[model samples]
Target: MDVFRSMQIMVRAIELGNLSAAARELGVTQPTVSKIIAALERDLAVRLIERTTTKFTPTEAGQRFYERAKQILEEYADARADACGLSAQVAGLLRVNAPLGLGEMHLHRITQCFVRLHPKVEVELVLNDRFVDLVEEGVDLAIRLGGALPASAVARDLATSERFFVASPDYLAQHGAIEHIDDLQRHEFIRFAWLESGATVEVAGPDGSRHIALRGRYSINSALSIRQSVCDGWGIAMTPAWLVQDLLDDGTLVRILPRWQAAAQTLRLVYPSRRYQPMRARAFMDYLESEIEAVPGLTTSRPRC
Candidate 1:
């Protein structure tokens, strides 16, 4: 039995919860994955998985082995990368996760440039609207838009994002323009549902930083949806200025209460702690930070140190 390959396959199967999915991720056939798992189980003389009609559960022994297997696989990858001079070259698969709107608008160009600079590097961009567990999801890095991150991860500020209260020209013409925060209560608001708690947002405006309890005619978790609704004259929304810059410039959307600014959210480049960050991972983070710094509104232009 190829013990290492079997271990890798089993670990991936446990993570993905099925053989077919694991096979697809590993670039192998389902039968091959099944055979490998079966062989490994027979050799070990322990049933690693409990398969039922509806689900696959790892046995206690399976869980223990999987934990060690992941470490072994990661170490092996690190050693291989080091041997190939990847420590000196930015070359490998970089798995990155970011908000869908930011990924489509901002990250796409940066990723293209990074790939151009390092032709050997491959980037897997997962544009998810929901917050993902980087360690559990096997992501190398994530672009987070908010304040400081949890202590479990290391973060660097990529930019300071300014929030704007905006509405479409048609919506303002119909509902009349809002000159103050209190005016929001008189109109329909579109809220972005928090991913962790599915709860609607009660945002604070700049004046007195008073929390405004908003009522949305429609609520969704997607930033894109909120932008679209505002564009369609559904309602006024509080969104990041970076997202609506083009719309504001082109007269598609107009900013209300332009003199008042809401709390700024920091754009962060977050990754697992250094202990867990491999050379390839660090390289990707470095590339991302450099690229983001070059973008307008992220930071003031300065000579590279």
Candidate 2:
């Protein structure tokens, strides 16, 4: 039996949660995939996967083996690339994930430029506002806003996103000028759906951070929707500067509470913790880091250690 080939099949099967899907991806028949997996189990004298009619999951031992097998496959790929004198070549499918707002506003353009530089590389950009399980979702890399890092992956700080309290010029004209912090309570706040922190909005300034009670007539999960709602003269929103920079510049939106801003959020790139990452992934990360300055309202400077 080809041990290496079997390992590849098993790894892909576990990742995809279906032997047939793995077979399709690896260009083999489903029966071939099942036969190989059965052979592996018999050889090891252990059941590697716990499968039901609708569910498939790796056992504890299988999980350990799967992790090591992935590392081995990466190492083998790297060795093959070097031996074939193709160490510098970047050719493969790279799955990238990012939030809906950032993905639509900047990541699409960045990916366009990246593919132009490396024509051999193909990128699948997945955009959503919900939390993503990187390994389970088969994502190669992810660009995420502020959150604690999971132990399964390594994170690289990319940039800082400064947020602001913004509203349409028409809304401000109709609601009267917001001359002080206390004035915010009288206006409607287009809140994010995920934020269940009551009606309070947090602001940071020279005096320190504080939360002030606010009213909201509307709420949505998407950042793009929030931006649109604000632009359509719905109400005020505390949104990321990157999301509304163009609107502010074009006089479609105006920044409120300039002296006190929402706490800045860090943009990070996260990927599985493999010792040997593919040349394609490394090159993509480096390229994205270098292009940080191109994203509006995001600063390249990280905080001093």
Candidate 3:
């Protein structure tokens, strides 16, 4: 068996999630893909994947191999590009993952400009609220928002987003104004469910470093859904200012406790730590950092140590 070719096939199979899909991607038949994986497993003396009739899932070893294979492939590609004097050209597919709301609101314009600047680079953006494993997902970069990131990834702060407690005028009219954090318990709150443990909203007021215990009548994982629910007067919500800045300016949404500020969230451009960062990735990050700084009220200052 050609070990390198089989390894490539195995990587494709894991990424595509099925032999048929891998076959299509590799321009081969399903049996050919299966045979390649079978040979690869035999050569490695380990079961790389667990397969059922309807689905295929990688084993822990398989996941590790997949990540390593991606790094190896990226290094090989970079070396080949350098040999061919294509390193400066920046031509290839660049995969990015970002939160759905932010991607829709900001990334599209950045992507347009990026493509215009590097005409040869093809971009694929996956927008989801879920945090994805960059290496396993084969993502080139991820745009993340919130507090401190995992130490495993290299992060660069792109912008700072202030958090605000907002509710529609209609909701406030019915529920009365929430003048204090204690009042939040009496009111129905729309919570962003994905803000998991270790996350706290720091509100400045009479009680310094006050962290409110969040209780919600309705919980959603999507920022877009949370915004819509808040706009429709479902309940008071704490969200990034950028998501509701227009509504606040237009009198559709009212900011509660404007005097008691909530901790700000930072937008970060993150990628897996590697020995070598590709020129395309570096250039894209540089462009994004520049563009994001130009936005009003958003600053790119380094976060306090």
Candidate 4:
């Protein structure tokens, strides 16, 4: 039995929760995977996995072995990379995750440019509004828009983006004008379905900061949907500047309570670990930092020495 190959197979099977998925990912047959696991169990004289009709789970010993095997695989890969001078090479599959709206507006184009620059690099861009586990999902890097992050994640602040309370010109014309922060109480507020700042918003102005309770008839989960709703003259919304900069420039959307603005949001590049970062991931981060300056409302937040 090839112990190294068995370790690799077992680790993948556990991570994916089944042998079939592991076989598909590793490009091996299901029977081959089963045989390897059986061989491993026979060699160790212990049952490594427990199976049921629904799923497969690791035994107590199997769980411990899986953890150690995963570490061994990672260390082996790192060692091989270093020995082969692969650390400096940018040829590999890179999985990236980003918020849906931001990914559609920016990261898609950014990824295109990156792949074009380094033809050997293959990128998979996953766009979603939900939280992701970087290691479990096999994501190399994630572009996060808010400050809150998982404790296990290592983040590098990418930029700071301004947020604004905005409405369409037609909406303003129909609903009248907002002169004071309290005046917002009388107008419709388009609620963004977010974990942070759900029912209330804090804005800063010359008079200082005020926390206002949001009252709205319509609530949407997507940034693009909120922008469209506000653009259609539904209500006013507090939005990240990057999402509406173009509309603002074209007069499709106008900033309300122009003197008052919400707290700036920090964009972050998040990864699973600080140790053993691949060359491709580092290259992508550097490329994004270089291009961030040209994006409106986004200012670099790189720490200065």
Q: In lDDT terms, which candidate is top?
A: 2
Prediction RMSDs, each to the true structure: 4.0, 2.6, 3.9, 3.1
Name the TM-score of candidate 1.
0.77
Q: What does the lDDT read for residue 256 in candidate 3?
A: 91
Query: Model 3, range 1-305, lDDT digits (tens) per residue?
Result: 88778878888788778889889988999998887888888989999989888879999999988878766776787899889988777766788898898878778788889989998888888999877888767788999987556566888778888887899999999989888778876777887776664234668876687877766668888888988999998988888877888788889899998877777878889998876666678778888887876554456774443
Which candidate, 2 or 3, would have the higher TM-score against the true structure?
2
Tens-place lDDT digits, model 2, residues 109-170: 99889999988899999999766877667687999998788898999999887887999889
Q: Provide the overall lDDT of each model, using Cα atoms, as 2-decimal numbers.
A: 0.78, 0.87, 0.81, 0.85
Q: Evaluate model 3: give its lDDT.
A: 0.81
Count clashing residue pairs in model 3.
Answer: 0
Candidate 4, position 15, lDDT: 75
Compute the lDDT of residue 234 as modeled in candidate 2. 91
TM-score each candidate.
Answer: 0.77, 0.92, 0.81, 0.86
Q: Which candidate tops TM-score?
A: 2
Task: Name the candidate, 3 or 4, with the larger lDDT value.
Answer: 4
The TM-score that candidate 3 achieves is 0.81
- lDDT at 69, model 4: 78
lDDT over C-alpha atoms for residue 73 of model 1:
79
